[model samples]
Target chain A: MKLTRTGVFTIVVALAFLAVPYAATLLGSNYVITLATRVAIYAIVAVSLDMLVGRSNLVSFGHAAYFGLGGYAVAISAFHLANDVPIFGWAGTNEALIAWPLAMFVAGFGALIIGALSLRTAGVYFIMITLAFAQMLFFLFVALKYYGGDDGLSLSTRNLFAGNRITDARTFYWICLAALAICLLLSWRILNSRFGMVLRGAAASERRMAALGFPVYRYRLAAFVIAGMMAGLAGALWANQNRFVSPDMLSWVRSGEFLVMVIMGGLSSLVGPVVGAAAFLLIESYLSGWTEHWQMVFGPFVLLVAVFAPRGLWGALRGKGDV
Target chain B: MQLVLEQLLNGLQLSLTLFLLAAGLTLVFGIMGVINLAHGSLYMIGAYAGAWAAAKTGTFWLALPAGLAAAALVGAAMELLVVRRLYAREHLSQVLATFGLILFFNGFIAWSAGRSPLLMETPPQLSGFVEILPGLPYPAYRLAMMGVGVAVALGLWYMISRTRIGMLIRAGSDKREMVEALGVDIAKLFTLVFALGALLAGLAGVMVGPIRSVQVGMGEQVLITTFVVIVVGGIGSIRGAFAGALLIGMCDTLGRAFVPMLLKSWLSGPLADGLGGALSSVIIYLVMALVLIVRPRGLFPVSG
Candidate 1:
C-alpha cells in the first residue's frame, strides 16, 4: 500500500516510541521511560475515543467509566486472588491472560448498556447522559468498601505476562507500546473498511444513512463497544503499570483529559490521538515541574487550541488546506 | 409520616436550587445553541464571590448581590470573549471550548482561594428554625430558599410570557435570524439572557453556600444534576426545567432517605447501605434515562 504523509509520520512516530526505552537508558533517566509508558497507555484511550468522537461524531463525556472499569477489573481480581477470597462467590485469578480479556469484556459490556441508553439521545443530551452514567459507576466503585471504597485498591503485584516479569520499566513500556500498536493497526483497518465508511456516513447524517438502509444505531453501538473495549485494554495496562487503581481513574475529569488529548491530536486523522496524547503528557510533565498552577496556563492553551485549531495538531501539521 | 414530610421538604429545597441552575443552562442552550460545560464554573464563581463577600461584610444580604454581580460580570465577559465566537461553531467545538473554560475557572479559583473550602455563615436571623407543621420545625433558611425559588419561577413566567423582552427571547430561541431581521439586536438579547442565567445560578450558589460547603469543583457536582434536570424537563423549556428539577430532587432525596431502610429487611446492613447509597445517587440518572426512553425530547419539549 502507498503511504501518505500522515501514514509515513505515523510509522516514524511508532518507531520513535519503540526506541524510547533505549533512548531513556542512554540518557539515564528512568522517569522518561515511565512518562513514555504513560503516554502510550493514554494514547490507546485517546485513539479509541477518536473512533467515536472524530469518525462517528459521538462525543462521549464519560469514557473514563470504561477505562476505570478495566482498571478495577484487574485490581479487584488481583485483590481477591491474593487474599484467597471469593468475591460474590467467584474465585479471582491474577493471571494477565485471564484478567486482561476479562477487563475488556467487562468494560465492553458496560459500554453496551450505557451506549444503548445514551445513543437514544442526540447532541447535548447524549454528552450529559454519558457523563451521568460514568458518574454513577464512579460512585458505585466509591461505595464498594471491600475494594477500598474512595481510597481505591492496589494489586499485590502486576499481572504476570505468561510468567514474564513485567515489573521492569523497559518491559512494561514495551508491553504498553505493543498494545498501542495493535490498537492503532486495528483502528486503521476498521476506519478504512466498509464498516468504517458506514460509521462516517452515519456521523455525517444519520438520517441520510438511515434512508440508505444502514442500521445506524446498531453501528454506533458497535463502535461504542469497540472503543470501550480498547479503552479498557489501555486501563488494564495502566493498572499493571502503576500497580494501583483509584476511583480517580474513573472521574469525569479523566474522561475530559482523554477528550482533550483527542482534540489536541487532531480528530480528523487516525494518528492524531497518539500525537495528542504524547504532547499532552509531555507538556503536562514539563509544565507541572515548573509550577504548581500549570493548569492555569494549560487551560487557556487548550481553549486557544479548541477555538483556533479545531482541526488539532495533526490537522495543523497536515496543513490547513487538507482539512 | 413526619420523616417522609421532612424528606419531601428537603426534596423541595434541593429542587429549587437545581431549578435555579437548570433554568440558566437551558436558557443559554436554548437561545444560543451552545452547550456550555462552563455553566458550572459560573456557579463556582458565584459561590466563591458570595463566600468572599460574606467573609468581608458579615452580611448575607450584601453577599447575595455581590455573588450575583460577580457571576453576571464573569458570564457577560465570557459571552463577549469566548462564547461569541462559538455561536457559529458545532456543538463539539462548543463543548470543548467550554470544557477548557471549566478547567481555567477551576484552576483560577484554586489558585486564588487556596485548596481549602470556604466557610459562609448563614445570617443569624435566617439560621433559626421555624415551625412549618404542627410538630415539625424546619430551618428558616431552607423555607426562605423555597420561597425565593417559587417567586423566581413566577417572575420568570411573567417575564417570559407577558413582557416584550421575554417575547423577544422566546422568538430568538425559535428564530434568531427572524429576530435579527426584525431590528432586535440579537447579540445584546443573547448577552442579556446569558447574564440573567448567570445571575440566577449565582443567586442559587449564594443561597446554598451556607448549607453546602463552598469549595472548588462543587459546581461540577451540582452541574451534572442540573443537566439531568434540563434533560428530563425537555431542553429549552423553563416550565420543563421546573418540573424536572422537582421530580429529580424528590426522587433523589427520598431515595437516599428510604431506599436503604427498605432494603435492610432483605440485605445485611453494610451491603444495604452500600447498595442504597449507590442506588440513590443514580436515581436521577435513571429518571433521566427513563424520560429519554419514553419521551426523547423531554416531558415538556417546547415546539419551535
Candidate 2:
C-alpha cells in the first residue's frame, strides 16, 4: 500500500490534535485544550452527518436530536446517581462504561423510531419530518422539569472510568481523540463495505437499486442508526467536557450548524468533516473574540462557500481531480 | 361554553396568521423549487420595519403599509441578489444559502435594534372589546385581525383563481419551460411572486406586532410552526396550507386550553399543569406525526 497525499494530511492533522494538550500546558492556558476537545467531539458529529449527506444523499435537518439525547442520557443518570434516587425502578450509576453505552443506545433507539417514520417520506418531507421530530424531543426535554427544564442539569463531576474519574484534561482529550479515530475508522470501513455501496447506490438512483433487488430502505435505516449512535457518543463526551447539559444542545440551530460544518469542510470523504469541524470552531472563536456580532461576518462567509466553493475547503485545498 | 367559544376564535385568528406565512413559503417552493430557510427572516424584517414605522408615526395604521413595503422590497432584493442564483442549484445548496441569509439578517437586526424587543401599541379604535355573543365580549383588535385574515384569504382566492397573474402563476407551476417559451419573463415573475410572498409574511408580522413583542428571532419560531403546517398541508398547495393551518391552529389553541384541565382529573395540580403545558406544546407535532403516518405526502400533495 502506498502512502497517498490524504494519508500525509491525516497524519499531520492527527499529530496536531495529539499535541494540543502539550501546547496548552506550555502556553499556560487550558482553553486551548477545551477548544481542541470541542473540535474532536464536533468532528464526530460532522462525520456522522456526512454518512447521510455525502454518501446516502439524505439531508437530515435534525441530527442534533441524537446528539442531545446522548448528553441527556449521561446527565440524567448522573443526576439520579448523585441524588441516590432510583429512576424507572433501577438505580443509576455514573460509570462511563455503563452510561456511555446507555447514551449510544438511547440515541440509536431514537434514530430507529425517527428514521422509521421519517424514511417514509422523501426529499423535503424527509428533511422537515426529521426536524420536527427533533423539535418534538427538544420540547419533551424542556417540559420534563425534573431534569432542570430549560435551565438544564449539571453533572457533579465527570463520569468514573473503571472506578476512577478521568479528570485530567489531557486524559479526556486523548480519550476523545481515540473515539474520533475509531469513528473515522468505522466510517471508512462502512464506506468500503457492501452496505455502504448499497447506500451510495440508492442515493445515486433509488429505483435502480430497488430494481437490482436490494433492500434499500433497510440499508438506509441501518446507516441512520449507526450515525445516530456515533453522534450520541460525541454528545456524551461533550456533556463531560462542559459538565453541564442544557436544552440548547438539542435546538434546531445546532442541527443547522452541524450541516454547516459538514458542507463547509467537504462531504463524504470521512476526513472532510474533521477538518470542517476544526475550521468552524477556530473561525467562530476568533470572530466572536473580535466582536459580539460575529455571525454577521460568518454568515456572509458561509454564503460565499455555498455560492462559490460547492466542494468546500477540503475540495478546494485538494486541487482538481482528487475527489 | 363562553371560554370554549373564545378559544375557538383564538384558534381561528392564529390559523389565519399562520396561513399568511405558509402561503408565500409554499408558493415559492412550488414555483421556484427552492427551499428558502430565510423566509422567516423576511417575517422578522417585516415586523421590525412595521414596528419602527408605527413607533415613529404613533399610528398602527401606518404599520400595515410600511410592513408590506419593507418586506416586499427586501424580499425582492434578496431574490435578485441571492435566491435567483440558487434556482438551478440543489435543495441542499438553497437551504444552506438561505440559512446563511437567516444568520446575516438576524445578526443585522440584533446589531441595529440593540437586542431589545420593540413594542407596538394597539390602536384605540381596535383595543376595546366587542360583544360577539349576547354576553361574551371578544377583543375588538382580534376581531379586526380575523376580518383582515378573511378578507386577505378571499382576496388571495380571487386573485389566484380569477386574475390573469393567477393564470400565469398556475401555468408557471404546471409548466415552467412552456411558460418561459411563451414570452413570459420568468425572472420578473419569480421576483413578483417572491415579493408578494414577503408582503404576506409582513402582513402577518404587522398584525402580530401589537399582540406579541416584535423581536429578532421571533420569525424562527413561526417559521418552524409554519413548516409543520406546510408538512401537514401539502407542499405547493394553497388549499393544503389553509387546511393544515386551521388544523394546527385549532389543535394548538384548544390543546393548550383543555389539556391541563383534562389532566387535572387524574393527576395532582402541579404535575398536571406542568405535564399538560408540555403536552399542549407538542400536540400539534403529534398531529403532524399522525398525518405523516396516515398520509406521508401530506393531505393534498401537488405532483411536481
Q: For candidate 1, lDDT tens digit of each residue in A133-242?
A: 99888888887777898998888899988877688898888888889989998999999998999999998899999999999999999999999999999999999988
Model 2 chain A: weakest 10-residue lDDT segment is A314-323
Indicate which candidate wins on lDDT: 2
List of chain B TM-scores, one per candidate: 0.98, 0.98
Docking class of 2: medium
Please, what are the lDDT tens digits per residue for candidate 2 over residues B71-144? 99999999999999999998778878888898899999999997988999998899999999999999999999
- Which residue runs of candidate 2 sit more than 4 Å off their true CA positions? none
Stretches of model 1 off by over 4 angstroms after superposition = A1-3, A320-323
Q: Tens digit of lDDT per residue, candidate 2, span A1-323? A: 88767777777888999889889989999999989999999999999999999999999999999999999999999999899999998789799999999999999999999998899899988888898889988998899888898999999999988888788988899999999999999999999999999999999999999999998989999999999999999999999999999989999889989999999999888788999999999999999999999889989888888988879888776667765
Q: Give the per-residue lDDT digits (tens) of candidate 1, residues B158-228.
A: 99999999999999999999999999999999999999999998888888899999998999999988988
